[model samples]
Target: MASTVADVAKMIDHSLLRPELTNEDVRAGCDLAARYAVASVCVKPCDVALAATRLDGTGVSTGTVIGFPHGSSSARIKAAEARTAVSDGARELDMVLNIGRLRGGDDEAVLDDIRAVVEAAPGTVVKVIFENAYLSDAEKIRACRLSEQAGVAYVKTSTGFAPGGATLADIRLMRANVSERVKVKAAGGVRTLDVLLEMSAAGAARFGATATAAILDDLSGRLARTGVATVRGDLSTDRRMGPDR
Candidate 1:
Protein backbone atom coordinates (compact mmCIF):
# COMPACT_ATOMS: atom_id res chain seq x y z
CA MET A 1 0.00 0.00 0.00
CA ALA A 2 1.16 3.53 -0.64
CA SER A 3 1.95 5.82 2.28
CA THR A 4 -0.24 8.81 3.06
CA VAL A 5 0.91 12.35 2.22
CA ALA A 6 1.17 13.03 5.95
CA ASP A 7 3.43 10.03 6.36
CA VAL A 8 5.69 11.50 3.71
CA ALA A 9 5.72 14.94 5.32
CA LYS A 10 6.73 13.52 8.72
CA MET A 11 9.93 12.19 7.21
CA ILE A 12 11.33 15.57 6.19
CA ASP A 13 14.22 17.10 8.20
CA HIS A 14 13.64 20.82 7.64
CA SER A 15 17.11 22.21 6.84
CA LEU A 16 19.11 25.20 8.14
CA LEU A 17 22.64 24.25 7.16
CA ARG A 18 24.14 27.51 5.94
CA PRO A 19 27.38 28.68 7.56
CA GLU A 20 26.55 32.40 7.24
CA LEU A 21 23.34 31.91 9.30
CA THR A 22 22.96 34.24 12.27
CA ASN A 23 21.53 33.64 15.77
CA GLU A 24 18.27 35.05 14.47
CA ASP A 25 18.30 32.36 11.81
CA VAL A 26 18.82 29.68 14.44
CA ARG A 27 16.06 31.14 16.59
CA ALA A 28 13.63 31.32 13.70
CA GLY A 29 14.47 27.77 12.70
CA CYS A 30 13.94 26.40 16.19
CA ASP A 31 10.75 28.33 16.49
CA LEU A 32 9.52 26.80 13.27
CA ALA A 33 10.44 23.31 14.44
CA ALA A 34 8.61 23.86 17.70
CA ARG A 35 5.60 25.26 15.90
CA TYR A 36 5.49 22.37 13.47
CA ALA A 37 7.00 19.80 15.86
CA VAL A 38 9.75 18.80 13.42
CA ALA A 39 11.69 15.61 13.92
CA SER A 40 14.77 17.45 15.25
CA VAL A 41 16.41 20.79 14.62
CA CYS A 42 19.69 19.68 13.08
CA VAL A 43 22.03 22.64 13.69
CA LYS A 44 25.66 23.66 14.14
CA PRO A 45 27.29 22.66 17.41
CA CYS A 46 27.50 26.31 18.46
CA ASP A 47 23.86 26.90 17.58
CA VAL A 48 22.76 23.81 19.48
CA ALA A 49 22.45 25.97 22.58
CA LEU A 50 20.37 28.52 20.73
CA ALA A 51 18.01 25.91 19.27
CA ALA A 52 17.72 24.16 22.61
CA THR A 53 16.95 27.36 24.46
CA ARG A 54 14.07 28.17 22.15
CA LEU A 55 12.46 24.71 22.05
CA ASP A 56 12.72 23.96 25.77
CA GLY A 57 9.07 23.61 26.73
CA THR A 58 8.00 22.27 23.39
CA GLY A 59 8.38 18.59 22.49
CA VAL A 60 11.05 19.40 19.88
CA SER A 61 14.72 18.64 20.55
CA THR A 62 18.01 19.96 19.19
CA GLY A 63 20.27 18.12 16.74
CA THR A 64 23.86 18.93 15.79
CA VAL A 65 26.59 17.75 13.41
CA ILE A 66 29.96 16.21 14.05
CA GLY A 67 32.74 15.80 11.47
CA PHE A 68 30.01 17.55 9.42
CA PRO A 69 30.08 17.73 5.62
CA HIS A 70 33.69 16.59 5.70
CA GLY A 71 34.47 13.93 8.26
CA SER A 72 38.26 14.36 8.39
CA SER A 73 38.55 15.14 12.08
CA SER A 74 40.30 12.59 14.29
CA ALA A 75 38.17 10.11 16.23
CA ARG A 76 39.22 11.93 19.41
CA ILE A 77 38.16 15.32 18.11
CA LYS A 78 34.90 14.03 16.70
CA ALA A 79 34.11 12.33 19.96
CA ALA A 80 34.90 15.52 21.86
CA GLU A 81 32.65 17.50 19.56
CA ALA A 82 29.81 15.02 20.05
CA ARG A 83 30.17 15.17 23.81
CA THR A 84 30.07 18.94 23.81
CA ALA A 85 27.09 18.98 21.49
CA VAL A 86 25.17 16.61 23.74
CA SER A 87 25.97 18.65 26.81
CA ASP A 88 24.94 21.79 24.99
CA GLY A 89 21.39 20.34 24.52
CA ALA A 90 21.70 18.33 21.34
CA ARG A 91 19.52 15.23 21.63
CA GLU A 92 20.52 13.96 18.22
CA LEU A 93 23.75 13.84 16.23
CA ASP A 94 24.06 13.78 12.41
CA MET A 95 27.69 12.71 12.53
CA VAL A 96 29.45 12.35 9.20
CA LEU A 97 31.32 9.11 8.75
CA ASN A 98 35.05 9.31 8.11
CA ILE A 99 34.34 8.80 4.41
CA GLY A 100 38.00 9.19 3.48
CA ARG A 101 38.88 6.26 5.71
CA LEU A 102 36.10 4.14 4.26
CA ARG A 103 37.20 5.03 0.75
CA GLY A 104 40.82 4.38 1.69
CA GLY A 105 39.89 0.74 2.51
CA ASP A 106 40.62 1.18 6.21
CA ASP A 107 37.27 -0.32 7.26
CA GLU A 108 38.30 -1.05 10.83
CA ALA A 109 39.46 2.50 11.33
CA VAL A 110 36.05 3.72 10.26
CA LEU A 111 34.19 1.38 12.62
CA ASP A 112 36.46 2.28 15.51
CA ASP A 113 35.90 5.92 14.74
CA ILE A 114 32.11 5.49 14.85
CA ARG A 115 32.45 3.59 18.10
CA ALA A 116 34.38 6.52 19.53
CA VAL A 117 31.61 8.98 18.68
CA VAL A 118 29.03 6.53 20.02
CA GLU A 119 30.96 6.37 23.24
CA ALA A 120 31.15 10.12 23.46
CA ALA A 121 27.45 10.73 22.87
CA PRO A 122 25.67 7.83 24.47
CA GLY A 123 21.84 7.90 24.68
CA THR A 124 21.60 10.41 21.84
CA VAL A 125 20.28 9.32 18.47
CA VAL A 126 23.26 8.99 16.10
CA LYS A 127 22.48 9.34 12.40
CA VAL A 128 25.71 8.48 10.59
CA ILE A 129 25.94 10.27 7.23
CA PHE A 130 27.63 8.31 4.43
CA GLU A 131 27.50 11.22 1.95
CA ASN A 132 26.26 8.72 -0.63
CA ALA A 133 27.10 10.91 -3.63
CA TYR A 134 30.81 10.52 -2.89
CA LEU A 135 30.76 6.72 -2.79
CA SER A 136 30.39 3.99 -5.35
CA ASP A 137 27.75 1.27 -4.96
CA ALA A 138 30.15 -1.03 -3.14
CA GLU A 139 31.44 1.72 -0.85
CA LYS A 140 27.90 2.76 0.00
CA ILE A 141 26.97 -0.79 0.91
CA ARG A 142 30.11 -1.11 3.01
CA ALA A 143 29.32 2.13 4.84
CA CYS A 144 25.75 1.06 5.56
CA ARG A 145 26.91 -2.25 6.97
CA LEU A 146 29.51 -0.48 9.08
CA SER A 147 26.83 1.82 10.52
CA GLU A 148 24.81 -1.28 11.40
CA GLN A 149 27.76 -3.01 13.04
CA ALA A 150 28.40 0.18 14.96
CA GLY A 151 24.75 0.12 16.07
CA VAL A 152 23.87 3.60 14.93
CA ALA A 153 20.23 4.70 15.04
CA TYR A 154 20.17 5.87 11.42
CA VAL A 155 22.31 5.65 8.28
CA LYS A 156 21.92 8.88 6.34
CA THR A 157 22.69 9.76 2.76
CA SER A 158 24.36 12.97 1.48
CA THR A 159 25.43 15.77 3.74
CA GLY A 160 24.02 17.82 0.86
CA PHE A 161 27.47 19.36 0.31
CA ALA A 162 28.55 16.95 -2.40
CA PRO A 163 27.53 17.20 -6.04
CA GLY A 164 24.56 14.85 -5.53
CA GLY A 165 22.33 14.00 -2.60
CA ALA A 166 19.85 11.18 -1.84
CA THR A 167 18.73 8.77 -4.53
CA LEU A 168 16.14 5.98 -4.51
CA ALA A 169 18.65 3.30 -5.43
CA ASP A 170 20.86 4.48 -2.55
CA ILE A 171 17.95 4.29 -0.11
CA ARG A 172 17.22 0.71 -1.17
CA LEU A 173 20.90 -0.10 -0.88
CA MET A 174 20.92 1.28 2.64
CA ARG A 175 17.78 -0.64 3.60
CA ALA A 176 19.23 -3.82 2.17
CA ASN A 177 22.46 -3.63 4.18
CA VAL A 178 21.24 -2.72 7.64
CA SER A 179 19.17 -4.79 10.05
CA GLU A 180 15.74 -3.75 11.38
CA ARG A 181 17.40 -1.83 14.18
CA VAL A 182 19.08 0.61 11.85
CA LYS A 183 16.86 3.11 9.99
CA VAL A 184 17.62 4.97 6.76
CA LYS A 185 17.44 8.68 5.92
CA ALA A 186 17.47 9.87 2.31
CA ALA A 187 18.84 13.41 2.17
CA GLY A 188 20.19 15.64 -0.61
CA GLY A 189 18.46 16.46 -3.91
CA VAL A 190 15.10 15.50 -2.42
CA ARG A 191 12.90 18.47 -3.34
CA THR A 192 10.12 17.15 -5.56
CA LEU A 193 7.21 15.21 -4.07
CA ASP A 194 7.87 12.32 -6.42
CA VAL A 195 11.44 11.94 -5.17
CA LEU A 196 10.44 12.27 -1.52
CA LEU A 197 7.64 9.72 -1.81
CA GLU A 198 9.90 7.40 -3.76
CA MET A 199 12.48 7.55 -0.99
CA SER A 200 9.86 6.84 1.69
CA ALA A 201 8.58 3.84 -0.22
CA ALA A 202 12.14 2.69 -0.77
CA GLY A 203 12.69 2.60 3.00
CA ALA A 204 13.76 6.09 4.07
CA ALA A 205 12.41 6.86 7.51
CA ARG A 206 13.72 10.44 7.34
CA PHE A 207 14.39 13.13 4.73
CA GLY A 208 16.53 16.29 4.86
CA ALA A 209 15.44 19.11 2.64
CA THR A 210 15.74 22.90 2.20
CA ALA A 211 12.79 23.01 -0.21
CA THR A 212 10.27 22.18 2.50
CA ALA A 213 7.48 24.43 1.25
CA ALA A 214 7.83 22.97 -2.19
CA ILE A 215 7.39 19.54 -0.64
CA LEU A 216 4.51 20.78 1.50
CA ASP A 217 3.04 22.62 -1.46
CA ASP A 218 2.56 19.33 -3.27
CA LEU A 219 1.19 17.70 -0.15
CA SER A 220 -2.45 18.04 0.96
CA GLY A 221 -3.84 16.71 4.27
CA ARG A 222 -2.80 15.81 7.81
CA LEU A 223 -0.09 13.20 8.43
CA ALA A 224 -0.56 10.39 10.93
CA ARG A 225 2.96 10.78 12.30
CA THR A 226 4.56 13.92 13.74
CA GLY A 227 8.00 15.29 12.67
CA VAL A 228 10.49 18.05 13.49
CA ALA A 229 10.11 20.02 10.28
CA THR A 230 9.98 23.83 10.22
CA VAL A 231 7.08 24.06 7.77
CA ARG A 232 3.73 25.09 9.26
CA GLY A 233 0.23 25.46 7.89
CA ASP A 234 -0.70 28.94 6.66
CA LEU A 235 2.90 30.12 7.05
CA SER A 236 5.36 31.32 4.42
CA THR A 237 8.78 32.49 5.53
CA ASP A 238 12.36 31.49 4.84
CA ARG A 239 13.57 28.47 6.82
CA ARG A 240 16.72 28.27 8.91
CA MET A 241 19.46 26.17 7.34
CA GLY A 242 19.58 23.15 9.62
CA PRO A 243 20.47 19.89 7.84
CA ASP A 244 21.05 20.71 4.19
CA ARG A 245 24.77 21.21 4.87
Candidate 2:
Protein backbone atom coordinates (compact mmCIF):
# COMPACT_ATOMS: atom_id res chain seq x y z
CA MET A 1 0.00 0.00 0.00
CA ALA A 2 1.22 3.52 -0.81
CA SER A 3 1.68 5.87 2.16
CA THR A 4 0.57 9.47 2.43
CA VAL A 5 2.78 12.24 3.84
CA ALA A 6 0.64 12.30 6.97
CA ASP A 7 1.29 8.62 7.46
CA VAL A 8 5.05 9.12 7.01
CA ALA A 9 5.08 12.10 9.35
CA LYS A 10 3.44 10.03 12.07
CA MET A 11 5.98 7.27 11.59
CA ILE A 12 9.19 9.27 11.91
CA ASP A 13 11.43 8.90 14.97
CA HIS A 14 13.83 11.80 14.32
CA SER A 15 17.40 10.97 15.33
CA LEU A 16 20.33 12.86 16.92
CA LEU A 17 22.89 10.07 17.28
CA ARG A 18 26.13 12.05 17.10
CA PRO A 19 28.65 11.40 19.86
CA GLU A 20 29.45 15.13 20.19
CA LEU A 21 25.83 16.38 20.48
CA THR A 22 25.51 18.98 23.23
CA ASN A 23 22.57 19.88 25.49
CA GLU A 24 21.57 22.67 23.11
CA ASP A 25 21.46 20.27 20.16
CA VAL A 26 19.31 17.85 22.10
CA ARG A 27 16.93 20.69 22.97
CA ALA A 28 16.66 21.78 19.35
CA GLY A 29 16.01 18.19 18.30
CA CYS A 30 13.25 17.80 20.88
CA ASP A 31 11.67 21.13 19.94
CA LEU A 32 11.51 20.18 16.28
CA ALA A 33 10.14 16.77 17.16
CA ALA A 34 7.29 18.36 19.09
CA ARG A 35 6.45 20.78 16.28
CA TYR A 36 6.57 18.07 13.63
CA ALA A 37 4.74 15.52 15.74
CA VAL A 38 7.36 12.88 15.09
CA ALA A 39 7.10 9.58 16.91
CA SER A 40 10.12 10.29 19.16
CA VAL A 41 13.54 11.93 19.41
CA CYS A 42 16.40 9.45 19.62
CA VAL A 43 19.54 10.40 21.49
CA LYS A 44 22.48 8.86 23.29
CA PRO A 45 22.06 7.20 26.69
CA CYS A 46 23.78 10.12 28.42
CA ASP A 47 21.18 12.65 27.18
CA VAL A 48 18.11 10.57 28.02
CA ALA A 49 17.64 12.19 31.41
CA LEU A 50 17.89 15.79 30.19
CA ALA A 51 15.73 15.12 27.13
CA ALA A 52 13.00 13.67 29.33
CA THR A 53 13.04 16.82 31.48
CA ARG A 54 12.77 19.10 28.44
CA LEU A 55 10.08 17.16 26.56
CA ASP A 56 7.81 16.63 29.55
CA GLY A 57 4.10 16.25 28.65
CA THR A 58 4.74 16.90 24.95
CA GLY A 59 3.72 13.35 23.97
CA VAL A 60 7.14 12.84 22.39
CA SER A 61 9.14 9.93 23.76
CA THR A 62 12.75 10.04 24.86
CA GLY A 63 14.79 7.33 23.12
CA THR A 64 18.28 6.06 24.02
CA VAL A 65 20.87 4.00 22.18
CA ILE A 66 22.51 0.90 23.66
CA GLY A 67 25.85 -0.61 22.53
CA PHE A 68 25.61 2.36 20.13
CA PRO A 69 27.24 2.46 16.69
CA HIS A 70 29.55 -0.31 17.68
CA GLY A 71 28.01 -3.44 19.17
CA SER A 72 31.15 -4.87 20.75
CA SER A 73 29.96 -4.09 24.28
CA SER A 74 29.38 -7.10 26.51
CA ALA A 75 25.86 -8.41 27.13
CA ARG A 76 26.04 -7.47 30.81
CA ILE A 77 26.97 -3.88 29.98
CA LYS A 78 24.20 -3.54 27.39
CA ALA A 79 21.64 -4.88 29.84
CA ALA A 80 22.73 -2.34 32.47
CA GLU A 81 22.49 0.49 29.96
CA ALA A 82 18.91 -0.51 29.10
CA ARG A 83 17.91 -0.58 32.78
CA THR A 84 19.47 2.80 33.48
CA ALA A 85 17.92 4.51 30.44
CA VAL A 86 14.46 3.12 31.20
CA SER A 87 14.77 4.32 34.78
CA ASP A 88 15.78 7.73 33.40
CA GLY A 89 12.43 8.13 31.53
CA ALA A 90 13.29 6.90 28.07
CA ARG A 91 10.28 5.21 26.47
CA GLU A 92 12.20 3.55 23.65
CA LEU A 93 15.42 1.54 23.40
CA ASP A 94 17.35 1.43 20.08
CA MET A 95 19.97 -1.13 20.96
CA VAL A 96 22.62 -2.28 18.49
CA LEU A 97 22.66 -5.99 17.77
CA ASN A 98 26.11 -7.49 18.51
CA ILE A 99 27.36 -7.92 14.96
CA GLY A 100 30.65 -9.47 16.01
CA ARG A 101 29.03 -12.29 17.93
CA LEU A 102 26.41 -12.93 15.27
CA ARG A 103 28.87 -12.89 12.40
CA GLY A 104 31.30 -14.98 14.42
CA GLY A 105 28.65 -17.75 14.35
CA ASP A 106 27.82 -17.57 18.07
CA ASP A 107 24.07 -17.24 17.53
CA GLU A 108 23.29 -18.27 21.10
CA ALA A 109 25.50 -15.54 22.52
CA VAL A 110 23.87 -12.95 20.26
CA LEU A 111 20.32 -14.06 21.05
CA ASP A 112 21.12 -14.18 24.76
CA ASP A 113 22.34 -10.61 24.63
CA ILE A 114 19.15 -9.32 22.98
CA ARG A 115 16.93 -11.45 25.23
CA ALA A 116 18.58 -10.13 28.35
CA VAL A 117 17.92 -6.53 27.34
CA VAL A 118 14.33 -7.32 26.35
CA GLU A 119 13.80 -8.89 29.76
CA ALA A 120 14.91 -5.67 31.42
CA ALA A 121 12.52 -3.51 29.42
CA PRO A 122 8.95 -4.10 30.59
CA GLY A 123 7.05 -1.13 29.15
CA THR A 124 9.77 0.24 26.91
CA VAL A 125 9.72 -0.49 23.16
CA VAL A 126 12.99 -2.08 22.00
CA LYS A 127 14.14 -1.77 18.36
CA VAL A 128 17.29 -3.78 17.79
CA ILE A 129 19.62 -2.13 15.24
CA PHE A 130 20.95 -4.71 12.81
CA GLU A 131 23.41 -2.22 11.22
CA ASN A 132 22.20 -3.48 7.88
CA ALA A 133 25.05 -1.82 5.98
CA TYR A 134 27.54 -4.30 7.44
CA LEU A 135 25.57 -7.52 7.16
CA SER A 136 25.47 -10.17 4.43
CA ASP A 137 22.08 -11.34 3.17
CA ALA A 138 22.11 -14.52 5.25
CA GLU A 139 23.32 -12.71 8.34
CA LYS A 140 20.57 -10.15 7.93
CA ILE A 141 17.83 -12.80 7.84
CA ARG A 142 19.30 -14.64 10.81
CA ALA A 143 19.59 -11.47 12.86
CA CYS A 144 15.93 -10.65 12.13
CA ARG A 145 15.00 -14.04 13.58
CA LEU A 146 16.92 -13.33 16.76
CA SER A 147 15.08 -10.01 17.11
CA GLU A 148 11.73 -11.80 16.69
CA GLN A 149 12.57 -14.58 19.15
CA ALA A 150 13.69 -11.99 21.68
CA GLY A 151 10.27 -10.32 21.39
CA VAL A 152 11.30 -6.84 20.26
CA ALA A 153 8.93 -4.32 18.65
CA TYR A 154 11.07 -3.39 15.61
CA VAL A 155 14.15 -4.24 13.55
CA LYS A 156 16.25 -1.19 12.74
CA THR A 157 18.46 -0.87 9.67
CA SER A 158 21.34 1.42 10.69
CA THR A 159 23.07 3.57 13.31
CA GLY A 160 23.90 6.31 10.73
CA PHE A 161 27.57 5.78 11.65
CA ALA A 162 28.05 2.95 9.21
CA PRO A 163 29.46 3.39 5.69
CA GLY A 164 25.98 3.09 4.17
CA GLY A 165 22.51 2.97 5.73
CA ALA A 166 18.93 2.07 4.98
CA THR A 167 18.64 1.07 1.35
CA LEU A 168 15.24 0.21 -0.17
CA ALA A 169 16.47 -3.33 -0.83
CA ASP A 170 17.55 -3.76 2.79
CA ILE A 171 14.25 -2.47 4.21
CA ARG A 172 12.25 -4.82 1.98
CA LEU A 173 14.41 -7.78 2.92
CA MET A 174 14.13 -7.09 6.64
CA ARG A 175 10.38 -6.70 6.39
CA ALA A 176 10.04 -9.96 4.49
CA ASN A 177 11.89 -11.90 7.18
CA VAL A 178 9.98 -10.55 10.18
CA SER A 179 6.37 -11.28 11.01
CA GLU A 180 3.58 -8.64 11.02
CA ARG A 181 4.09 -8.47 14.79
CA VAL A 182 7.45 -6.82 14.00
CA LYS A 183 8.12 -3.75 11.82
CA VAL A 184 11.16 -2.12 10.20
CA LYS A 185 12.76 1.21 11.12
CA ALA A 186 15.03 2.68 8.41
CA ALA A 187 17.75 5.06 9.51
CA GLY A 188 21.16 6.46 8.38
CA GLY A 189 20.05 8.18 5.13
CA VAL A 190 16.35 8.99 5.18
CA ARG A 191 16.65 12.67 4.20
CA THR A 192 13.87 13.65 1.76
CA LEU A 193 10.18 13.09 1.01
CA ASP A 194 10.97 10.97 -2.04
CA VAL A 195 13.57 8.94 -0.16
CA LEU A 196 11.17 8.50 2.74
CA LEU A 197 8.33 7.50 0.40
CA GLU A 198 10.64 5.00 -1.26
CA MET A 199 11.30 3.21 1.99
CA SER A 200 7.69 3.48 3.12
CA ALA A 201 6.68 1.80 -0.13
CA ALA A 202 9.17 -0.92 0.67
CA GLY A 203 7.50 -1.54 4.06
CA ALA A 204 9.27 0.74 6.58
CA ALA A 205 7.03 1.86 9.43
CA ARG A 206 9.56 4.15 11.15
CA PHE A 207 12.23 6.54 9.90
CA GLY A 208 15.33 7.90 11.64
CA ALA A 209 16.74 11.08 10.15
CA THR A 210 18.59 14.32 10.98
CA ALA A 211 16.98 16.24 8.10
CA THR A 212 13.34 16.35 9.16
CA ALA A 213 13.13 20.13 8.75
CA ALA A 214 14.18 20.10 5.11
CA ILE A 215 11.77 17.31 4.24
CA LEU A 216 8.85 19.00 5.99
CA ASP A 217 9.75 22.27 4.30
CA ASP A 218 9.40 20.59 0.93
CA LEU A 219 6.06 19.11 1.90
CA SER A 220 4.75 22.47 3.06
CA GLY A 221 5.85 24.07 -0.17
CA ARG A 222 3.92 21.50 -2.13
CA LEU A 223 0.79 22.09 -0.07
CA ALA A 224 0.98 25.87 -0.37
CA ARG A 225 1.32 25.83 -4.16
CA THR A 226 -1.71 23.70 -4.75
CA GLY A 227 -3.97 25.43 -2.18
CA VAL A 228 -4.62 23.14 0.78
CA ALA A 229 -8.29 22.54 -0.11
CA THR A 230 -7.64 21.39 -3.69
CA VAL A 231 -4.25 19.86 -2.96
CA ARG A 232 -5.06 16.84 -0.92
CA GLY A 233 -2.70 15.02 -3.30
CA ASP A 234 -0.62 15.88 -6.43
CA LEU A 235 0.32 19.33 -5.22
CA SER A 236 3.63 19.34 -7.02
CA THR A 237 2.13 20.61 -10.30
CA ASP A 238 0.72 23.78 -8.73
CA ARG A 239 2.75 26.99 -9.13
CA ARG A 240 1.34 28.71 -6.02
CA MET A 241 3.50 26.52 -3.79
CA GLY A 242 6.14 29.29 -4.29
CA PRO A 243 9.89 28.70 -4.21
CA ASP A 244 9.68 28.66 -0.41
CA ARG A 245 6.68 28.22 1.90
Where does model 2 exceed 4 Å of error?
1-6, 228-245
lDDT of 1 by residue, 1-245 (tens): 44444445566677778899999988987777666555767888889888888889887768888998899999999999999998999998988999889999999999988888988988999999998778999998989888888879999998988988888788888999999899998888877666665577688888887776666655542221234343343222222312222
Worst 10 residues of 1 by lDDT: 236-245
Q: Roughly what TM-score does model 1 have, to 2 decimal places? A: 0.86
lDDT per residue, candidate 2, 1-245, as tens digits?
33345555678888887878899999989999888877888988889998898889888889989999888898899999999999999999999989988888889998998988899888789999999777899999999999999999999999999999999899989999999999999998888766776677688888898898887767666665555623233222233444322
Tell me how far the alpha carbon of residue 83 in candidate 1 is from the true structure, in angstroms, after superposition: 0.4
Query: What's model 2's lDDT at 46?
Result: 89
